[model samples]
Target: MERTILMADGQSFYASIEKAAHPECRGKPVAVGDPTRRSGIILAACPVAKERGVTTAERVGEALAKCPDLVVIRPRMQTYISVSLLITEIFESFTDQVEPYSIDEQFLDVTGSLALFGSAERIARLIQTRVQLSTGVCARVGIGPNKILAKMATDNFAKREPGGISELSRANIEEKLWPLPVHRMFMVAGRMTAHFARMGLHTIGDIARLELGEFKRRMRARMGRQSDIQAEYYWQTANGIDPSPVVSGMRSQIKIINHGRALKWQTYRTFADIEPLMLELLIEVCRRARRYGYMGRVVAVAAAETDGQRSSGFGRQMTLPRPTYLEHELSSVVRSLFLTHWKGLPLTHLHITLTDLSRDECYQLDLFEDRSRLIRREKTVDAIKERFGATAVIRASSLAPTAQAFERAVQIGGHFA
Candidate 1:
């Protein structure tokens, strides 16, 4: 009958990730940061570091003063980003209701479905367990009647227990909420705290003592009342009320069905290096065309020329003697097209686009040329790549001097020497 929001917070997420990947750091105090001589500030601290008095965003010097033996590690963005995506996939497996609150925090609505798994407490514990199993990191979860309460409940549990779960409901609001610090009121961050202090309202109980409207009138007029919205949020949380939904109603973006490569090299050394690149670009264009059941009839290239002049490569509509997903056949067309168009010009950036697509690929055979046989052979090449891999099929034209010129270029950063 009541809705619940489950908040999953990876305890000291970044630091935990490093420690998880390397078991050698287990149980030792560790801080995630860029440990430079000048000042390596803390980004996140592990549970061990927290136990030793290190906290996030603290100066390296201050953190060291607080915890002398803190082991600070430089973060690898790539690894952390992958971990974030992996966690997101796990959340999606449970419910699309998963909404990421931050890199390590998420809210899931389990109101209607908590019973399918177990109680809200059970669900939270299960999520924490799975995160550990998959990521080698522990998580803390708060299960509450609303998002506000759920988040606070989770934070409350995390500070006191590791890999812990707690549930907050209207039934337990007063007994659980009242004794907490007056300053523990929800949504009362720095600005609201300063304003409340200025108005001599020192605690949640102090604000609760006044008329809601009067409380606003004394603080900062409209702004003070606005803070009440946040106050009301936490007040309701303390009362076991949450107005937020776990299920976020948002649409997923369509994956790129038609992929294209837009390339920019530092500089083009010769016509040799630029030509193979054209075939490389076209191969991608044709692959997307095949996936989407289309064939592009026009292929064109654009380049930045020497002397700061911009030159558009010659473009022509091409109909394969047969429709192909074959690298060799497409390579032949690309080579012929490049030779006809390029006149030994040095270039910087090159953009190749294949356009004028036909979704209906079946064409009537001309009496002058029977292209059907070529199409079937090309299709076989496509199958090899589909089964083996992208790099599985390379045309003989790939041997064209164009492919090797860049490798031989004496230029630094690919610029002409």
Candidate 2:
């Protein structure tokens, strides 16, 4: 039996959520972002805002200039997360096989539920209606035989359709999807589109018409060795021949654990000024490794200058004497890396990564140090935080004026909660 897959996405997710919450903003232009911050850009904009020349990722001031009466709402990350989860529940009610492609988009495999429901189109409509009625946020759905086509159908067709539902299949793909510009296809952004055009492939049909071997040969010539896999991926996507399954409760294996943050406008020039934040990041990274039941033999630290130049940053890694998920061990190496590499340039970004991991089962003891006692203390701290909140039992250094842990606790993605 052919699988029935749907890619459902919330229309203008953040902006729509803000509009739904504030009844007065209905039918007016709305954008979600904070204008005062250095990174203040329109995160999401409603259809009304888009029609008025407002675009996502544009400066808030630019959006305001476009739509004079634009209602700018600060993003409530936690609230958006709650609504996303609610939409997931609504989707789960219709089918057990649902995979979240992103916070605003999800894929549903309803092949098994066709008898319980009526048709793929009907199920798409039902899911759309359910999400809208429950959350007051409009949903657009694209139905297909597989995930790639479903997502493409959503991005290209469903979003433009009045009914906000469209279907694409291998049989009708050439008629409906092929004539569209190559950039209109998923993963074919501006640069790729230009490259495709240079190769005399201006439309989806152009790529699809190429023999697989010829396409791979051309891609390899331009992209160099080992480009065959990526070349084939694009070819498959163009032909709507995805074979990947919609996995429920999907989790990717953790090969490395890392955490990093970009400073909005604050640039630390002194080692003393940067130490607290770096320590906090190292502690957090170690906590994550411990929680994942993994220990690493390598630790990496990165510092990027505030100038935004690609060459301004330094990233260095060091192999540990042994694998351990303890904060002290990681912090010792990270601090050394920062002190050695940071050239007194004003730093706007900091990062810590743990890699070369193995199962965190046991550790070799040292003759000088009581390893078991330190391990027990770390485990206890993890236990307390798990029982309470992440910020419940923070290090005393977090209380320092320079520390970002307390501030970061309430924010998501560097924006206010």
Q: What are the models' TM-scores?
A: 0.59, 0.60
Error of 1 at 177 (Å): 2.0
| lDDT string, candidate 2, 118-139, tens digits | 9999998898888888898899
lDDT of each: 0.65, 0.87
Best by lDDT: 2
Report the C-alpha lDDT of model 1 over 215-303, residue by residue, as the tens digit. 64664463644665655554454455555566552323222223233334434556666666666666666666565665555555544
Clashing pairs in 2: none
